[model samples]
Target: MQRLATALQIEHDASLRTLNTFGLPAVARTLVRIDSARAVRRVVDHPEYGRAPKLVLGGGSNMVFTRDVSPVVLKVEVRGRRLVEERPDAWIVEAGAGENWHDFVAWTLAQGWPGLENLALIPGTVGAAPVQNIGAYGIELKDRFESLSTVDLVTGRSVTLDARTCAFGYRDSVFKQEGFGGLAGKSVITHVRFRLPRPWQPVLGYLELERRMHETGNFAPDAQTVFGWVCDIRRGKLPDPSDVGNAGSFFKNPVVTVEQCRDIIGRDPAVVHYPMPDGSVKLAAGWLIDACGWKGKSVGRAGVYEKQALVLVNRGGASGAEVVTLARAIQESVYGRFGIRLEPEPVIV
Candidate 1:
């Protein structure tokens, strides 16, 4: 434990705002920051601390800490990247879990790697990306996901899990579920590997992206161009944490039955829906929030972002309780009005 303290910052009552984008003023019981996997394993396996619950933290961009965190906080700082293998059309790149996701994308783009260009500017770490299966502009993390290595907290053993074993689907993974007594929260991700396309074709499935590509006349946009467009769109639409604290897209788009969607559409022809392959329909969570008149609605310091209804912003001097309350109100209102319950995208810690 003393060696662990010497290797990293072991702070008591650390302000969490500096770590998380939500800007909530919460404190950690024991925050341990580690820069390498070796240090991470060392701290977890320390004999002095036996069976203490631990929380794995990354960029803290996509999570909302609703209260003072229990257990020890393991702030992953592992960082590095290198091309492990390459083919004519693609390369296998391994990145430390704590590496900034956007920086990795930029680095890959500069090196002429193309698969991650469309995912540019997303806030968080490489480790957190796989947990959410993050997607944007018609691309998903799983599409390029090769595998990842995680440290099993119970046994202090490192394990490598492939794509199929990950059980990734719609922003979820095996780590998020529990098959045993209650739920197990004892796994910590250490690193992620991505199998990226080399001469990548920019995905243009999102209508906004297609429109922008058309506007630029770069019909076959390369990685840089696609990256630029994604950055532009994200910057213009999403609120920067520095200016207005927020977790992008507070709720996921609810996938409902076709019959349910058809009933809603029958009542209002303008109801927007995206057809899914499994005969379900994805309804716009933003539209439902806007319909409930929650967009830009403020309660104390928490409010729906003025620009994007799907995002909840912290306007300074707000408690986590206020934000959660506002979110619940919005959820209840949407369910009452449309018979659909909006699910939050950010993990509530």
Candidate 2:
């Protein structure tokens, strides 16, 4: 086991093929494994790497590497989990940054915690959760986020950030922001805490979950059952990255105003649109791509998933450049048809 302040083992020319869920080919010139907050500080204080450009690599479930990485790769492997506090109103749970998101959700359910059940089966690490503001089945990480501990790369100072400080937005957070006061690429998250409220309420607002209830005749299901349903739903809808090299939901659902949505509906009455509480409508990216006739289509080795157009899959031997090219084409077509620019969900490196 590597210690925090021990001399770091820096691997050279490291292959990132298996590290990323997309299974894209790429190599890092220099890579360091950070298993603790102190390890991050140690790297920051190191004479050689203290000032070098850094790239924090998580599960790589939400990234597209276009070429070989030039920045120093910090592979976070911090690990720990504990029930921080049990209150009458809620249970506060903490997990290390490296903990697998899905596994953590299942662990919480196994321990009788229920809030995270709606977010089950989502890939990536707990650390990357805040960066992407990950959400599914009507629950976003911000809904249950307490605070997170991160060490600044420049100052080597550790800070705990609350939800407000995180500046969480739709599929975004301060950590993902590179604007004023943003922490993007400037710090490394070491741990995250989640507050699960008592008197658990199952989030059954999503349509697919409702459909599952209708089909199974199990309307009032428990958290464990909901977790199982989510896993089943995702498996049926999204392709497994293990079987096929791909990133899940390559594009974010485009949100438009009610008026804009009405315009789109006027053009295509069958457009799938969901109304938001804030008067905006979220158009299904899959529907938009499928409407553009991109489903099951291929450009070189990169192709739109036959089952779900939102996902772009690598048929075989596909380069990251090809994936980006296909994504750009899809974006252009969708924009031309709907007059709404679809944003990509994954970070393109």
Best by TM-score: 2
The reply for model 1, stretches above 4 Å from the true place, is 1-8, 179-184
Error of 2 at 306 (Å): 0.9
Least accurate stretch of 10 residues (summed lDDT) in model 2?
1-10
Score every model by TM-score: 0.95, 0.98
Q: Write the per-residue lDDT of candidate 1 for residues 1-349, one digit (tens) a residue.
A: 2234436567777778879888888888888886776666677667744378888788988778889987888888888898889988779999999999999999987887779987888888988898888888888899999899887777767889899988888877776777763113677788899999766767888888888978988788777888899999999989988788888889999999999998888876777789998999999898888988999998789999888888899998788888899999999999998899988888788
Q: What is candidate 2's lDDT per residue for 138-232, written digit by digit as tens?
A: 99999999999999999999999999999998888887788689888999999999999998999998999999999999999999999999999
Clashing residue pairs found in predicted model 2: none
Each prediction's Cα lDDT score? 0.83, 0.92
What lDDT is obtained when candidate 1 is compared to the true structure? 0.83
Candidate 1 to truth, TM:
0.95
Which parts of model 2 have CA positions greater than 4 angstroms off? 1-5
